[model samples]
Target chain A: MSGIQYLFPEYEVVRNDDRCIRCRVCERQCANEVHCYDEGRDKMFSDESKCVNCQRCVSLCPTRALKIVKSDCRLRENANWDSDTIREIYKQAGSGGVLLSSMGNPKPLPVYWDKILINASQVTNPSIDPLREPMETRVFLGKKPEKIVRGEDGRLVTDLPPQLELSLPVMFSAMSYGSISYNAHASLARAAAELGTCYNTGEGGLHEDFYPYGPHTIVQVASGRFGVHEDYLEAGAAIEIKMGQGAKPGIGGHLPGAKVGPDVSRTRMIPEGSDAISPAPHHDIYSIEDLRQLVWSLKEATGHRKPVIVKVAAVHNIAAIASGIARSGADILAIDGFRGGTGAAPTRIRDNVGIPVELALAAVDQRLRDEGIRSQVSLVVGGSIRSSADVVKAVALGADACYIATAAVLALGCHLCRTCQSGKCNWGIATQRPDLVKRLNPDIGSERLINLLTAWKHEIKELMGGMGINSIEALRGNRKMLRGVGLNETELRILGIAHAGE
Target chain B: MKRVYVNEEWCLGCHLCEYNCAFANSGARDMVSALKGKPLVSRIRVEGDGRITYAVSCRHCTDPLCVTCCISGALRREDGVVRIDRGKCVGCLTCVLVCPYGAVAPGPDGAALKCELCLQNSCGAPACAAGCPNRAIVYEEREEERS
Candidate 1:
């Protein structure tokens, strides 16, 4: 085999001989096959070169003897001709291919949430204790009737359209089955079911075992339209029309042939081991009017039983985009920001494209309210809503709910190694390898997810209580409670918040 | 020598480490008495903004930059744990600027507070590891280097 290495291996695995138990938990847990037992020497050895510093082997090592350290090796330090850029050059020269990266962009971008402050009641208003008062986090997302209806017989008519009722103002974002492990999907499904919230099935299609979670699932139909059928359409509580993603923006996604195992192939309704690449844009949709057509068509296909959500990336013209989406006969709009994670994407696009979710959400919400179409649809904001404070800020910025994935992954023991594309996820959340997949117990994963969300819900209640807002509805679009600290006039104008001490 | 190490994956960012550390060094019998109205400026801190969170404290580097950068002779290393002398001299923040982890910060009293491994006032194991709810923080030493 012709050997060509572009990037230096970042981690070196250290195995202790005296503490070796030979249980092979590390061997079984690693998808890269770094660890192996030599029958001739009867000893456990690791190649070390295959390590990604994911800490899978180190965490699973029974004897606690395994550790990974950053390689001290370096290329001559130059800022412009940096090691990473040089390595990329070498790799592209060798393979003549674009460098693909996984997870969110790690660049130091300005996060607007930290720049915004939430106002707490002092003398003018008294902060209510969440423990003593009822705070409503429950939300119904759909087109609400402009006014209460009255029947001809004088009996009050309660007939209304279908809405997605959430126990809290948070839900699991779309992470495809092909991108994450079966156990991860199962954990999300179980957690959503137990929490009475919804989990999205990203373009990869829904799994068969998770049909019991259909009532809490939001199935997506992307440009590729994988695993989509009449039953698949009707199986979910809501259907999402994914026009674009925040990670790649203008670019589409491609699940490699190697990741398309038997189960992923079946669920995706694609031939096994074949590359599945979604096109940049839906062939049928070229304009906002075309998007409306598709939205109504999905509504017709599902007999208008399930709400149709139009999901898009937060791009430069997001306000205009959301305005059109509001008129698209869709019930909800899901906007994912730039810091969103991906299974894999060209490194250039992930780190360089798209705007922040906070700015996009505020702009869209303001535009819709200005256009007097705010009640026409619901908005769910995602991408880097890390804490309950993030959720409260998102709601105050005019989001109906928040979608979180990275935080959910953290609850399931992910170390944020950002090696999700390697498919050797030691935590078993993002990998498909059976060995690594089995390492994550669905029961435990779901419980941890529930615990994280429950804690966040309590925190959200406290934050709302401090604002003197007893209900989430009262907090939604309540911009008076938010103030900007270090943002400029334009930034504050876009966010619709006054300066701190204003 | 045992030093405070972290498995940041298990850290829930609960900030209990800071409370326990202050209480242990406060010489107060209970937590409420030690930290009732006084805003705490603990040696160890958790630093993160949303996407990924991790605990940050003294790594006690063999050749610590903070010790070298300190002009007031306030920062020092003893027995492998980086210790701070708040009363030595000035509140110059050179160590805070030099520390890579952003672990060193100006305390409420204008003195720099950095993790001292709970050695100045305690006898038992470090209070942080003992009070960590998730056991994400631990006091341990490196494995023996193999030939």
Candidate 2:
């Protein structure tokens, strides 16, 4: 084990000697200790083996003299057994542990959003200018009455269920405090408040410092129920029951003891330096009735003033499962697809477990309408909504809103290095270390997040205006404005859209 | 007057500000040719313990002690900026000793060196403040303290 080396360094740190001024800025900024100065040689050198390709050194280099590139050296190529497959086998043989990865799945799977083309008004209908006229992007998520009800006096009943309102149909999904840093959560909370949107507190109870932003918070309850209290339950505008996540659908979550620092432990109500592991499934929820009881319990605890959301992974029978949740008194259903992001997950389970969100969203919407219970629950789909176009496509396929975590963290300076499991995030969004966490100032992070969402809001308005739809409510479930470019008959039928030529 | 201020909370202590200052004042074509294999004499320096850090430079106080103590007339207060005239400096080291913030230092040619907010350089503004990645060093004007 000590003599043989099974793997080679994947990335090479290229430093231009002529351009490097020996400022040593890269050496100081990297948390991985990849770069160091050899005082005797009067030069700087990098240890490529420790480099994660996170681009921290390259970004902070004062002279722009550093670049990271994938090593060109490779093993003999085979069509069926690629280099990555062979490397994974060697790694497992040596370590005897499951491969862990961070962020979303990187496989080249089918992306329905890319295949779907949007329509525009031609010579007949006129397109509205968003700058000149009013374009309503606001949406309210909650159950709606099937028909107008009248009291004994024949007057219209105006009372409706509690709802979660948003300036735009996009939200920052659940990335818990224990999984990310305090500054990341601070940035999200401030940005959500500024944008008139909501951010989910993924199973990590609400931090006391974020209580002022409660109106823009969604507290989540998972199988472990890490920090469930009366104050914690009341600290958010809505509650989410996280039955499963998109990444590692059938497995549970585990935050290593090293990351369970005092702040994270206090926030999660766990002892310091102890691992926080969530069970695979809720112990009390074996059937739909059990789900209904929990939903009602949360609603009752909140005094029936806040909406309840049930989040589940998009799987084979998602349409039927959504039907059960809709009838279980849950006001909102959040479906996480296969490509969702996570702080840590088994590589195999993350790569191959759940179904694509586009098909799941379409099937559930159609099934709920067929069952005449579509009005009882609102649908929100998440996994990898990358841009405004994805959000627009999701709404056209009957999603009330879209949840985005990877894109949100990217806005806060994540390079998508896919090495968050190591917990030494150089960019500061995923690490709990005080030095690394301080790298992300909430002032800059919040401003950047606000800028990203504000830009997306304008793009959404433009896309809606191009379709001659001035309001988001008018674009909801409007499949007539969508066409499939490379979809087969079954996919086109499932998506309920016509072929591009037709 | 606009002045450079430091907020210790966000300082990353990466020393990029010091490098930017040296390069901006070097007057060379680029940072590589100016600072390569050279001992840096940056006008701004960062002072920190392990846990906390902050950049220090000329404060340009209302009544500067360095300006009063310069016997060779090298240090002068011009439009609220305490600037050093390297040509007239006598290398007495009086200003370096008199500066309370320890910002005044001797240059390579035995002249007193201090921060002029980059006004004398091609930058036309403070490079240390501009190059700060975390906005820890800022150049702005705020309400004066009554005391």
**Scored by CA lDDT, what does every candidate get?**
0.85, 0.94
Error of 1 at B51 (Å): 36
Per-residue C-alpha lDDT of model 1 across residues B26-80, encoded as one tens digit per residue: 8877655666546665777777663345678877787789999999888888876
Residue A133 lDDT (model 1): 84
Candidate 1 global Cα RMSD: 17.1
Docking class of 2: high
lDDT of 2 by residue, B60-146 (tens): 888899999999998999998999889999999999998999999999999989999999899999999999998899999977632
Q: What stretches of model 1 exceed 4 Å from their correct place?
A: A1-6, A14-24, A36-46, A153-157, B1-147
Best of the candidates, TM-score: 2
Error of 2 at A18 (Å): 1.0
Q: Report the error of model 1 at residue A171, Å.
A: 0.8
Query: Per-prediction DockQ, in order?
Result: 0.01, 0.81
- Looking at model 2 chain A, which ten-residue stretch has the lowest summed lDDT? A1-10
